[model samples]
Target: MLEMYRSYLAACNERAWDTIAEFLHPSVLVNGIPRTREQYVDDIRKTIAVFPDYAWQLRHVVQQPPWLAVHLHATGTRHQDFLGAPGDLSPVETDEFAMYRIADGRIAELWGTADNARLRLSTHNETR
Candidate 1:
């Protein structure tokens, strides 16, 4: 499972959308809300559109059977307006924590949160 997770993260960092669905269940739940795998992938597409250089770096992980807890550091430069922030802003850095529920060797559910305050501040920073 750990090796699978590493491959998943690598695929994400490489923007390898073609292989992403292989790691996700056809139906996934995020934050308690059910979503199709396509919907989940679309959300990622939107983010990448806004931050073309965005990348997620794995910092830590703990896997115990069907449950996995992950810590990631994400960074990206704002190339377009997003969430009330102007475009061409400085790089935005954020930390995200994610909990995943694995079912049938695929990611079936996820609960995650990021340091949005810091991300917003970086995006809206005037000094940039």
Candidate 2:
């Protein structure tokens, strides 16, 4: 299971959404928001479109039967306009955490949160 998580993260870092299909169920929930497989992939795709170098580095993981909690440090550089701001901004880094329910060796559902305030601050600082 841990290996699965690692594989998933590696795929995510590479922006290889197709490779991630093996790790995610067809129907997954992210932060209680139901998302189809395509939708989930598109969400990340949109993010990468704004920050071409977006990456997530795992900080920690806690495994309890049927559940895996993850802590990660997310980093990216603004390469295009996003959230009303222009591109070429400084790099962005934020803390992110998620709890995922594993079913049949795939990620069935997840609830995750990121330090949005800090992310916004990065943008604010970059603009000034």
Candidate 3:
């Protein structure tokens, strides 16, 4: 199961959405973001466009029946426009953690958290 997560991350880092699809269930729910498979793929593509050098460093993995929690640090430069904001303002490094429900050896659902305060500060230069 940990290997599956690793492979998924590797595919994501490589912008290989097709490879990612291979490890996800047809009904996969990513980070509680209600998107279909195609939408999910598009989201990833947009993310990579915004953070071209985005890299994920897996910190820890905990596996249990029907679930896996993954802690990771995602860091990258904001090199392109993202979410209606311009890019190249500065590099942003954020820590993110995700908990996933695995079913039939594939990712079925996911919930995630990130350094939102840091992201906001880096995105708009405002402290919250």
What is candidate 1's lDDT per residue for 23-104, written digit by digit as tens?
A: 9999999999998888888888888888888899999999988999999999998778876767765689888999999989
Displacement of the residue 86 alpha carbon in candidate 1, Å: 0.7
Instruction: List candidate 3 stretches off by more than 4 Å.
Output: 31-34, 81-86, 120-128
lDDT of candidate model 1 versus the reference: 0.84
Best by lDDT: 1
Residue 114, model 1: lDDT of 86
Tens digit per residue, CA lDDT, model 3, 23-93:
77776777665656667677778767777887889998888868898888887778776555457656677
Q: Which of 1 and 2 is ahead in TM-score?
A: 1
Identify the leading candidate in terms of TM-score: 1
User: What's the TM-score of every candidate structure?
Assistant: 0.90, 0.88, 0.82
Candidate 2 structure quality by residue, lDDT tens digits, 1-128: 78899999999999888987768899999888888888888988988888788899999999996999999999888778666656766678788999989999999998988875555446446553
Error of 1 at 116 (Å): 2.1
List ranges where model 2 is wrong by over 4 Å. Answer: 123-128
The lDDT of model 3 is 0.76
